[model samples]
Target: MVERSHKPGPISATTASSLPQAQVNVSDDNSKVTATIPSGDTVEVLLYGATIISWKSNGTENFWVSDAAKLDGSKPVRGGVPVVFPVFGPPPKNHATSSLPQHGFARNSRWEYLGKSTSESASDDSVKMDFGLYSAGLSEEAKKAWPYDFGLVYSVTLTKGELSTILTVRNEGKEGFDFNVLLHTYLRIKDISTTTISGLLGTSYVDKVLDARESTESNSDLRITGETDRVYKSLAQDTTTVVENGSPRFDVVRKNFRDTVIWNPWTEKAKGMGDFEPKTGWREMLCVEVGSVAEWVRVEEGESWEAGQTIKSLV
Candidate 1:
């Protein structure tokens, strides 16, 4: 059986003392588990509610998750993958009418560490860790919001050179439930301005920054420039995908998620990012998220849904 607990129990509590802590069990295939933070602390980044906080390594910080949240509680102590679910982006003005937390509480709330296993896919090779959150803990909030019992399971595995995430949502209530979700990932980059996303050519996307009002389809490969944010619609069913291209390009293969979000805070917004480093303009990183925002997933009672993304570094 897998050991389970909520919040960074004893280890996470001691991080304030700089004594080095152990929160969630670090596990690998063969059921082996360790209870200490791993080595290599050149720098640290955060994943807050599925948002990238910051990433620093070897004297250079490539990704910007958020610099401001370090003072607030929305930051993650662990420097790797953080899972987001149920909803993404800003909350609707009427959060009371919704059963979701601000970007859902999966990232902020502690998860029950399920266990570990080997990769089941042949193309990918790495260990996998399982984490889960239930609606039971949020029943009071749910009752006031939408009043439905549901369960969410998130799994993160460090494979080869990248982290992979699998999100599963189950409807445990008698009634149906519906909502949007996103894997709001902040990827580390050599340079954001020089990075280009291929494999999306001829694919159509709904430009969010251009206007949340229209669905603009794209057929050409995109290169990041300014504050560009767009939601793609009716995307191809194939899993072949790519995010960054240069000496090293990140290739992403997704399952079940049909929408893609491309975002970068180019000029003024980049400076305003709380946790973001100063003088790091559009040269930092990009946020290319795999999500389903415009579409609402409806899971029936006793039914469950799963979505995931596998990332590979071609660098």
Candidate 2:
């Protein structure tokens, strides 16, 4: 029931040239672009959604993708860091994207590979690339759902011990538009029950699991038990930490993104997802997304907005 994008052939030398001296490899099916670092860290990106399908540190994968994930672009891959734009969950009441998909057309549409770059500084050596989608490249269905000229540029950077993503949106139309966006990150964990998220204390959030009720987080550390879906708004801090078994795992930092979405399908909801591996998949992954979703961003003509998130390992 999902729409698929056209698959390209393997990346050629000319395509690899965009990355300069970095080690760039294309997927066998030519749907992905992978950049590897000398320190054994690597990042794989799918052109379909500019999705970060994999990120490995010291040969250990930090991201999770469902075993039953549709890499052929049939639907948005069920894992990794998916770029959500224009709208977050459902469309705002009577909004332009009301007729579009749940997260809008950005994740579902194919993006054009812009280029890649490598930066060397005193402390870090990183490889980064840009993938873009414009109103002209959007599908007819998407154009009809929200007819406005727009441009989106997504940048993925991989450093020695960190992965960063920056998303910038430009309004090219004659009028302004309002929208929401997020980085729907599915982080891999050793065990979901043993995981605890901190730094959201006193932050007000919308509890999606309990009929979208609003509540304040009084607990210093939040643990998962059942199906959990909450959107923490107007964070007092810019960073949050994820710990497992009393050991810090990773730190998530956000810039210009005011909200954080925490989700876990748990048991019953996980059973209904066809793209997710049924039995044990939910136990291996948790979603701790960061973005500007609680409120809408209004962009006027020829204006732009940028938001970013960086994930660093604490181990």
Candidate 3:
């Protein structure tokens, strides 16, 4: 066995010789699984949508979940990390995803666990769990909405203070298809008003609240004072940070993702949604989502594409 270290995670997949044991807890009904690394970090994933509802690092929850989130598979979970595939937001009128729901069926559809792998190095012990969502496994209603053979492998890796999520999509059909994918990550914070985002100093973005007009960011450290929803593109750096109360809280770095979406519904907008409980939940969360959305990714027959994000805790 590779001896563990007290130092936090470094957030990269590794190949080790011996198979390290994964500390896991699975629900009796198979709805969720909670896996832990040897260094005391844990991650909880639900089978429905293969969504991660909880990721705890050093006993603190990094991802946020709404108090009114529906976990019974009756509807999509309101918060945390919800996988968006095949489409993002509303569908265009004359498109293959026209008949699909707002963010496609990936978040509402149930997924299957493909199992887990654990490895240990001198630095820490890491566990990577996989989930599968195949076209044949989707509901008939979803199939009829957008018919195309595909396979999605969602992997979650945990090592101390970092949680990395990766998705690999393969086209399993005879013909090529176009799709868009994203991970809607709701990062919990001490307070939204105190949170500031750096590294987007001069990036251009599409302000969705302002009728989706193209705009340029002028702030050196962006702060949210009102309802905000903007899609930032062509970022100067691949690594960005979330600073709360003048302290660096989280560092987010992505691979193969070309766009970053920053969002917070604030007061009036939060009150408008029925699922947004407490009416003040917006003050405790900030969404820094990364994905490929400026243009659709086309996967030819027998071809595959992949993208992912890694979050490091700075607390």
Quote model 2's TM-score: 0.91
Off by over 4 Å in 1: 1-82, 92-102, 119-125, 139-143, 215-219, 237-248, 279-282
Worst ten in a row by lDDT for model 3: 13-22
Question: What do the candidate models score in CA lDDT, each in turn?
Answer: 0.58, 0.89, 0.91
TM-score of each: 0.72, 0.91, 0.92
Give each prediction's root-mean-square deviation over alpha carbons: 12.2, 12.2, 7.3
- Which residue segments of model 3 deviate by more than 4 Å? 1-21
Question: Which candidate wins on lDDT?
Answer: 3
Q: Which segments of model 2 are wrong by more than 4 Å?
A: 1-21, 121-123
Query: Which candidate model has the greater lDDT, 1 or 2?
Result: 2
Q: Which candidate ranks first by TM-score, i.e. highest?
A: 3
lDDT of 3 by residue, 1-315 (tens): 776688678777655644455687779999998998777789999999999999989889999899889998999898899999999999889999999999899999999999888777777789999999999999999999999999999999998899999999999999999998889999999899899998788899999999999989999889999999998986879987999999999999988888889999999999988888878989999999988876899999999999999999997
Candidate 2 C-alpha lDDT tens digits along 1-315: 765587677776644335334577776877899998767689999988888899999778899899988877789989999889889987767777798889988887888888888875435668898899999999898999999999999999999889999999999999999999999999999999899999999999999989999999998999989899999999999999999999989899998999999999988888888888855788988899999999889999999999999999776
The CA lDDT at 265 in model 2 is: 94
Question: Residue 26, candidate 3: how far off, in angstroms?
Answer: 2.2
